[model samples]
Target: MNDRGNASARLIAPLATLATVLLSIAGAAPLRAQGGAPPFDVPAWAFPTAPPPRPGTVPVVPDSVTRHTVPNSTRHYTRKQVGNAFDIPDWFPRQHPPMPAPVQYGVRPEGRACGFCHLPDGQGRPENGTLAGLPVEYTVRQLRAMREGTRGSANPAASPNPMIAVARGFSDDEVRIAARYYARLQLTRRNIVREVAQVPTTRVAGLLYALDGTGREPIDGRLLEVPESIERHDLRDPWVRYTTYVPTGSLTRGRRLATQGPAGPTTSCGACHGPQLLGTGDVPPIAGRAPSNILRQLINFRTRARRDSTAASMYPVVDSLTIHDMVALAAYVGSLPPSRTPRK
Candidate 1:
């Protein structure tokens, strides 16, 4: 019995030593792999990572988004391609109304009619913005933006020949004539305001109204401010641009969304734009402007069709907004004041 016990102890001693050595090696392996720190000792959130640069690929740095430049002056001439001008056919409208010739200008020259780019009845093509049923002041402000170069042409590569070129050449009187023409034209029933009731109180802008749970006053009666801040971001020389007016209630709704909303994934308007809804740096103004244009732009952003620097900034914000929010916001912005022409 004593001799058997001695043999078992001898065997157990060496085996125990071997097991400890193996355990030591196993424990040390992770530390060695991680350059001295044990695998478990590393921070819970720490990820094993290397610098972004790879052997053959260059590292990429994101560019800062900027507002599009607005032009100061424009050159005009009779376009040679009258047929090529923007044209809207009668079939485009779900319901077409009889449009009288613009009373102020008599008849638009061969290529000078609203339908030229916006199509015959103002169903604008995707390439160009729509102009159907836009308020007179809103249309005027946009024309002025084009004339002054504040609003740039959508196609950058097109060079000197672009939408801005067409707008820049238009005289002030011509702009007014066009504004009046479109303002008088009745909007298609299909284009009638939807989501009017769905608009939330939180989305309405200054001096809350029925839309925002305030006074039940109709929009047509109130004097609204133009969204110069949005224009400022979109235009180059905001000082030189003209202002327009929209319904007070609509502008109020626009202001709420533009100024306040979600954070983190979605940013507030004041975060990128300045306080008071004026744009920061190159960001455009949104306080007072045309609702139709604003709605069109928001739609463009949502669809990823209008991808300029300024629009890109709005991508995150717009993505978070519901369709109802978008409509309410647009209605609000369209009601603001136009750029007050400065006194010379």
Candidate 2:
């Protein structure tokens, strides 16, 4: 740890200078905007919305209906069994919902399944997070944070993130069960990140972005990552994947900032996240995560909205970043392949 700190200190000054200049240019708003609206200061893009129906098909409401049929072997199972995230469909089920029936499917009094947003695989969308391979202790701590209001959504519009309420409602046993289940899964890489000057014209739909037109539009220093299969994602199909579109050269810039700080107030991620950035002990892995999710977390740390002993260390680390720097760092981290080693 001493050697790591010394090495990280070497890169801070240059990165800090670059970050200061970038922040001045971008002002204080987040890097993206919705429709023709002014750029908001919050990370509102982290929420997933119910996507629209294909060309002419009727939209399937996520919780109210089952668009796909269950297997023959389990066809006789009750809704309590089928609906539960824990009692998951077994047809090539890559991951299982770890919670009990009520927690997986959700009871009317409490709300939706824990997997409904995070997904059964624990590889959540940009709006949420990848829970796979997280430390059980770290996971439990975060749940406590949300329950205590020490951590939450930074976007005011996304304020009172449902997870806060969900955490508050959970029993200690339930949290432990869920955390252990997720911690046991192996991490896997998903989204493919690319930097481009122009991107498909998109509209802010749901808690994500959707391609809106064939006509190309400049990314304008904004980040847009969307699912390749809108219909499947809306169906809550666990197999769906995504593509992240960022500004050209963002990855290169991000790589520099991540592996070696330009100076200012940051250090190489490897200094603490392990040499591979796959995480060190209680520190969670940042590699191969959704860029949008990474950006949201960095923003949270900067704003001190995610307060905890661990996050307390992150505040100073992110304070010097410009929105552009955040975008670059997120892109670079999300581009790496996830560590596949199962946690002990």
Q: Largest lDDT belongs to which candidate?
A: 2
- lDDT values, one for every candidate: 0.38, 0.64
Worst 10 residues of 2 by lDDT: 1-10
What digit string (tens of lDDT, one per residue) describes model 2 on residues 1-344?
Answer: 01112112221222234333443343322212212222224333343344345798985444544335333222233333444544343333534544554335543444456676776668776677888888888988998887765675455344456676677767667777777878877667778998899888766556776666566867766677878776555545555678898999999999888888634325778877877788888889889888888988887666555766677667556766777888899999999888856332
13 in model 2: Cα distance from truth in Å? 25
lDDT tens digits, residue span 103-203, model 1: 11223232244555554444343224445545566566665654443343211111222344555556667667666655544322111222232222211
Who wins the TM-score comparison? 2
What is the clash count of model 1?
46
